[model samples]
Target: MERESSALLFIREKSVGFTARVALHEYKRQCDGGYPAKLKKVLIVTAPLWFKAPFRILRLFVREKLRERVHTVSAPQLGAHVPRASLPTQLGGQLAPDHAAWLEHCRNCYTNNLQNNKLDGVIDEYVISNYIPPVKTQNGVIEHEVARDMTSDRVARLEQPDAMHISDPPYTCDTGPLRHTHGYNGDMKGGHIHSGDEDEVDLITRGTWSSGEASPGLSDEECAGGGAGESAGALLARLRSLGRRGLVAEYEEIRARPPQGTFHHAKLPSNLSKNRYTDVLCYDHSRVLLSQIDPEDPTTDYINANYVDGYKQKNAFICTQGPLPKTYSDFWRMVWEQGCLAVVMTTRAVERGRVKCGQYWPAAAGARAVHPPFALLTEAVDVEDDYIISHLVLTDLRSEMSRRVWHGQYVRWPDYGVPGGGRAQPVLRFLQLVRRAQRTALADLGDAWAGHSRGPPIVVHCSAGIGRTGTFITLDVCTSRLSAEGVADVRGTVERVRAQRAHSIQMPDQYVFCHLALLEYAVMHGYLESADLNGFDDDNEDESE
Candidate 1:
């Protein structure tokens, strides 16, 4: 069977050498051999020069497609490096993230030969001269905006069987004398071509991989007044010629590696009203956390949301769940078993065997709460059943917690060992806790919780109950049908958890933060790396290794 293809996308790579090499490899392969058949005008699709890796790859992948006239599409249009800044008008060109980076890259690189319709043997002949989608510029400010003439000229470069569509360069500029301006903003007021408002633009000067190096083969005649120090235009032209070569040529160094998986991409459900307050929508994680505890059914059955929105009743006794148990679980279990069940509220893991059942405890990363901890479990001790309780002794507990947090010592974390963004300490810690909790749940229930118990042992894990508990649900979702975007139907996780119990991880960012934290830790430790993906290949033929 064919293996699953990679959906891994490159946000960008920091390697200049890699990008340039790849671009050149693609370009040379493209031009080196082929039928003597005619190849029409081509559109170059690239990541905003600032977005180096993905753009380079995107550019290479689309070369053949762009060579097909009329329907050509440029690199920036593909959404690989989306412009965060909005365009000024219908015709304005999109903003690049960083101009300086782009310039620096251009300085040391050679653009593709077909750029900007440069028929001559010049490197930057393809760099678009006209800016598009205008912006307002001032005398002293550097701005990013695509020019109208540039866009029209780009369209004009396209050809059809009957007629050629083209635009004449703005004849108003000082073309006769070949004179240039120094750092004049692209505004029309004082010979500057304006794109639009500054507030609307994001700075691309910093994002572009740029340098001051001139194109390798410019003649002294061509290099003269070449903006070494004279004018931005001269400098821009010089660098652009280089940009055409490749990102490696454009960017001096690209720190190549992997993607940061700390972020979770869950679009808010469309069911939400635009004016909704707090407006946070959780997946199965949140729902499961909220419904795991039933104050009424002390013997069994964690309370679930009675309705679609939520349930209103309370006072149910239920076994609670928590983020796959760790420092927090140990703390709760020790305290609960101490015969403090009445005086101190205690929430215990559900069914005892599942690792994620501990997410019920509502606690943050810090010192113990002044209010005595509580543990509530759904497993009812029948009149005949035996019970093994837990207790906590504070013997220098505060000091240990302190050492763990501030001193960066080996301290226990839930599902994860520590909270910081490095190492797999957290995951290892979590795995340990979950395995323990699951074992305990199963032994106590005699295999009842996975669905044999006459009444499901009320797994009650608590506090506000939301984020932590939701982690389990998220995991379940992840293990389900995976998408190319690295997303899962976590809402389903929450819904399933809600069916099991009430009042799961109640705090926001807890569920999201927990998973992200674990992932961050995994990523930093080299445990997780974006796999080489084949998703970007729009071509029909398989690429050779």
Candidate 2:
């Protein structure tokens, strides 16, 4: 029994019968975990009513051998493999499905560290690290509550195996329902959150201004000199003259051209297929290549990332996707390999009821998550109104080499939309904070980050790594160009970025937002005044195009 390894997925027809999509997504999420490495086989026993349902689509994502691990069997078939005395009665076994009793047993295991302080055969401090009691809220009148009893129950039962392995400190109460019911934080209510349904109008809703003469900064040739010494009034007047519609038209012209380089082909077959979209690729010449962990194969070395050059600084960013559950280790590997000083996350891990990115780092101070040779420890966290700054230490367990990496999590900015109106100020402020930290790190640890005085290409990522990611980098590059050289070239910068990484600035609105945001930056820095910022309708911005 100690040597035997197995995993089970129970399908309660009464619970997930109608919602196949949710079931499949949940299944994929399970598959995304590190279970395949430990388990020799995974069994699926559905409710008696469920027929041999089509679950073959799952094979495409998992490894070829791991796919063979999955097996769908009936209740009677389960009894043949397991002793009736130990099996649950709900699935034709003698032991009754006593979840309440099971919870108590599991709680004891956590309360008393067993199996050499390793819970459920997995060695990790996560279960016991910072156990908190459930939040108790008394009922209030006229309160709106999303009833989640059924969903909560399903999750509790599904995770019973792993839950039994929790090894933590003393319990708040001796008895009660485990105090923890899966990882749900009560934000999402039903089904997978789709990004498509979100209201882009929640951002600044502004109208299209008539296209007049283009702004001096809009033209690549004119901007070659710089926007420096350009007065606040004059800058706003120039921006107002060019308008959103004209800038957007110019962006489309750049987008229409076929990408210049072929560096993106370095992506491996597996990594390419894993990407949410295909067109998003890393340009070959400037791509941030991952040092292969395995010498024999180079396919796995591919991480959908690239080295984007800053306005003046060469190789300013290691732009990549928001880490997937499977790519968590790889993402950290890239960070360590690239010698990055800071990680700037522009999108929330989950946004607008959808999983925009995986939760790649630890949630609190003193907590540690190990991705094999790399162990990420959250040393400290500073939560700002517009962004969260986490102090993380990455220790290479094998060589014992360690490095501190900063994570600037900006949550105010919507997924595909700009931080509009008053919101724009926070973004500018956030960028300053990130740059300040990088500068300070460079000055303090001079020789440690020797070559990267401007700091190693700060790892910037959103969901797709191109849309919001590209916009943020563009802002950083152009803003720096304006400050140092006195010019900000939207067309030139966007084209250069897309050259390194494909389909960079995602939509027309994002393209327009870049110009508007640059104008906002000018106003914030005294180059433009608040009153001078006119002809800008915060509510008239169009996303339909």
**TM-score of every candidate:** 0.21, 0.55
Best by TM-score: 2
- Each model's lDDT comes to 0.26, 0.56
Predict model 1's lDDT versus the native.
0.26
What tens digits encode model 2's per-residue C-alpha lDDT throughout 24-100? Answer: 55555565564432333345566233333345444446665455444554443443233332345454433444456
Query: What lDDT score is found at residue 348 in candidate 2?
Result: 87
lDDT string, candidate 1, 1-545, tens digits: 00101111122212323454454444444444322222222223322445444543554455443322211123222221111122212212233345574464444233322354543654422222322222321111234332233344443543323221111111111221101111111223322233321322222221110000001111112211101121222322333343322222222221121111100111222212211122222221111111112234211111121111111111111222232332343333322221112211122233235333333322333223322233332222111111122222222232332100000111222332223453334434443343344344445543112211111112223222333333433332332212112333333333334322333333333333333433443344444463121332222134343
Best by lDDT: 2
In Å, residue 334's CA in model 1 sits off its true spot by 19
Off by over 4 Å in 2: 1-235, 263-267, 420-422, 530-533, 536-545
